[model samples]
Target: MNKGNEMAGPEKEILDGIATRSVYALGANAASTRYCFRVLRRFLGEGDVLELGPAEGLMTGLLQSTGRRITCVEGAEAFCLSLSARFPEVEVVQALFEEYRPDRQFGTIVMGHVLEHVEDPVAILKLAKGWLAPGGKLFAAVPNARSLHRQAGVIMGVLEAENALNDMDRRHGHRRVFDPESFRQAFLGAGLSIDFFGGYFLKPVSSGQIEANWSDAMLDAFMVLGERYPDIAGEIYVLASRPAP
Candidate 1:
């Protein structure tokens, strides 16, 4: 079903521009997306899945492998077109998360790397929570502000603050970075009960540095090592569900 809506004017252009950027295609980001999917697999419930902001369909490809009915809500027309062409099996809806209203609830709602870009994360989470069927789980992940690399940036005087957006963050259209505490508060603010909170990919350096120097084995090892130290991991995630009635 090609139920796609068009977004007009500057906002649409902005989104389409971001969609064409090569940031998500980076070696580190691609690897991280795979690792994030591995973490998400354990928490996925049975039935349909809803994925928000599946830019370039990196995680979308992984989600499709589960043989579950998958629907993706993406704002960028470019991404929507690419995703639809790349995975014709997936139903891609081109609407801002603020405007999307699905007819059915989902067993799993994923907001992978979405919070940092949104103008209102708690509001988005609240919407996702509302769209969850009973026993459904909402899985969300975002870059960690306190990750070793960010912290190192601060100490190196490259970043004015750990939470401050860097050049890469701006390039990626990230509005804010969340440390563990702030990240948890977003879920709680949305009235979601966290089922699992953890992190992955213990990056000791920037993505550029990693791509230039790190081997595949080292990348894989660090991806596993992030679990032991969630506080300083490159990315953090939560598996959450609505509070019982």
Candidate 2:
């Protein structure tokens, strides 16, 4: 539920409306999230962790496993309430990223699958940069515009272009799809240095297509395959830090 600060009235309602729906818990999506955590785990920072748009706490649950004092900031009240009840140890704050004013910096900040949903990805990244403790890292992942599935969609005439949003994108309230170049530029634009940039989940088709036809073994295999071909991976990630003074 990442949104611009200018969002108001109907726009706010629209985002909240999308939040009430259970999308991430689905079969393929759930598997993707697990794989996302596997990639995130390698670069997770020590001490406190700040997670943005945790949704149903799938990633929140994973972050808690590290025992790093988790705090989640989600804009949707329904999600905030659900997260609080589900993870009593977690501190869930219900507020938009633009309005959230944390009193202290954090060791790690995660924005898994969040940038594409926001109205201003660069602005959000800049905001996150300001909240990082010295040497802390910001980890963000977004759907790749050049993913095999997306490229296939364009070739199959299901999408207008590689960067075009599909049915799932609209349903999930995604504003844009990011390719490798644009994804890297967002971090650079935020004045952060790239510590690591790679991707995971080498999805060859749509989530629906995979869920209907693929086996768990096949799914697991592709999850790791993306590391070798990150440019076209289903999801890409960047680990960034503040430049040296």
TM-score of each: 0.97, 0.95
Q: Model 2, 1-245: lDDT tens per residue?
A: 32224536665676688787759878888998899999899988777999998988899999999988988988777788789899999988777788888878999999998999998999999999999999899999999999999999889988999999888889888999999999999999999999999988999988988999999999999989988899999999999999999
Query: Which candidate number has the best TM-score?
Result: 1
Candidate 1 residue-wise lDDT, 1-245, digit = tens: 34545555666666777887747856999999999999999888898999999998999999999999999998887788889999999999998887888999999999888999888999999999999999999999999999999999999999999999999888888899999999999999999999989999999999999999999999999999999999999999999999999
How much lDDT does candidate 2 score? Answer: 0.89
Off by over 4 Å in 2: 1-8
Q: How many collisions between residues are there in candidate 2? A: 0
Q: How displaced is residue 231 in candidate 1, in Å?
A: 0.9
**Counted clashes in each candidate structure:** 0, 0
